[model samples]
Target: MGNKNTIIWIIVVVIIIILGVVVVGNRKAQAPANVQNQTQEESTAEEESLPNNEVLPIGNNQSEGSANTDTQVSSTAIVTYTDEGFSPSTLEIKLGDSVMFVNESSGGMWVASGPHPTHTLLPSFDQKKTVQTGGTYTYTFTQAGEWPFHNHVKSSEFGKVIVK
Candidate 1:
């Protein structure tokens, strides 16, 4: 009888431990919900702030506005994303000018200014913000340099925006 009681007690302890682990795991998963909500809110606000959103064509690799060699900055530029990759693979924008990276791809695209995996070239310009088909992500250039960027999912496809 004593041995049987000891075995039953051990089984009960194991079950309690398992239940504790499952509860903790669930809490960990829910923790990110709050953070995700905040990020979505911020992104929505940024999109709302921009004006005159021009819808560029899919696979259109043309600069939305004419490249200005002089100091005059183009008001806004749209770079479309398709299976071929970012349109206008190379773009030139003036300081304080905004570039809208619009995704018209079938799946999500991760756009980040980079030197490959680490997007440290222009840290402020990097975003893991996944743009679903028809979604847009915009960034204003504050620094003057050639900022190379790539689709984090498809690294082979790359592009750069030259800020002058």
Candidate 2:
């Protein structure tokens, strides 16, 4: 009878330990769910506080007076170089626009410039396209600012893109 009682007590202790482990695990799992719920509630509250009628302007050549007009203009421009550098060293485009560079030189030599070296376009902009003689390269601008770029091959030959 004594041995039987000891075994029963041991079984009960084991069961209690298993139950405690399960409870702790359940609480740990529920903690992430609680955090997710709180995050979702905060996100919903933030969205509700934002203005509902806010709209972004689209198209090109947007001036103060032409803000309400629906006349859509092409925000893209083309810059071609045949002899030395870009035809228009100083270019003007909309805030969100793109420029295509066409290499018309005969030899395998082409480059462009901005506020800095054009080779830095890698890891920032699309520089995969190399302007090899007849090759063409295109770059798009999404941010608003004055960017000066220059060709790594020829630092003297540079250009500037004014984003308005």
Candidate 3:
């Protein structure tokens, strides 16, 4: 009788551990989907609020208007992303001009100013969130320099923006 009771307790403990693992695995899988959904919803809200040609400042350092004191957007440029990485690998734009990073790849892209990981070089250039495929992110160059950028997810791929 004692042996049978001990075996039952052990089985119950094993079952509990298995349940915990399964529950954790399920949550882990759902987390990314939940975040993605939330991001999409927020993006929709932002788009609805702003006009087609308008863009709000991106990061903490960026202000309400263009980087320059003029408070006007000079122009807009495009940088496309595919499996091969950013095309027009090196772009040259004037100050107060914006570069729109368009993701045309199979997966998401997190475009950020490099030295990678830290993204300290041009902090305002960081996208903060992943730009899903077919999505776009634009950053106006407030400062002029050779700004190197990369996909935070795929650090191996990179490009540079020459702001004049």
Candidate 4:
């Protein structure tokens, strides 16, 4: 029992350290090359000029000269589905933005406002539509709240989108 407890403590500490390193590394990697060497005021100005509340694409996706990604940065926001579940299990978006549910797995998926079968959490948001692999479903979020959703096909996999 004591050995098991010691092992658990060691595992927890290692996980925390790894998470910290990943977070720090991501911050550095996400910053634009032009802004990395700039003064604080310059960085502040750059941020102020960007579109607010929408998640900014990292790296060259933000560059005016780069347009190689299959998905373009448009008014549409994406929530991708995988074999396990949603790629971004939690998302934040501006009110009135469209949320695109892309089914990337071999299995079809159902996205509905939840409490499982009832889906009464946001009744009007309910739908029987199922998107197959490589297919998509989009819903415009006009209401401001944290909307909980799940894959009806795989009920246990769920996520929420907070609209500001």
Best by lDDT: 3
Off by over 4 Å in 2: 1-74, 108-123, 126-129
Q: Which pairs, if any, clash in model 1?
A: none
- Model 3 earns a TM-score of 0.56
Backbone N/Cα/C clashes per model = 0, 8, 0, 0
Candidate 1 structure quality by residue, lDDT tens digits, 64-130: 3333323346478899989899999999988888889888889788888898788889887866777
The parts of candidate 1 lying over 4 Å away from their true place are 1-74
Clashes of 4: 0
Q: Superposing all C-alpha atoms, what RMSD in Å does each candidate have to the true structure?
A: 28.1, 19.3, 28.6, 31.9
The candidate with the higher lDDT, 1 or 3, is: 3
Q: After superposition, how far is residue 31 of candidate 2 from its true place, in Å?
A: 81
Worst 10 residues of 4 by lDDT: 65-74
**Model 4 lDDT vs. the true structure?**
0.80
Model 3 scores a C-alpha lDDT of: 0.87
lDDT of 4 at 82: 90
**Over the stretch 135-161, how does candidate 3's per-residue lDDT look in tens digits?**
999999989899999999998879999
Question: Which candidate has the top score in TM-score?
Answer: 3
Cα lDDT for residue 103, candidate 2: 72
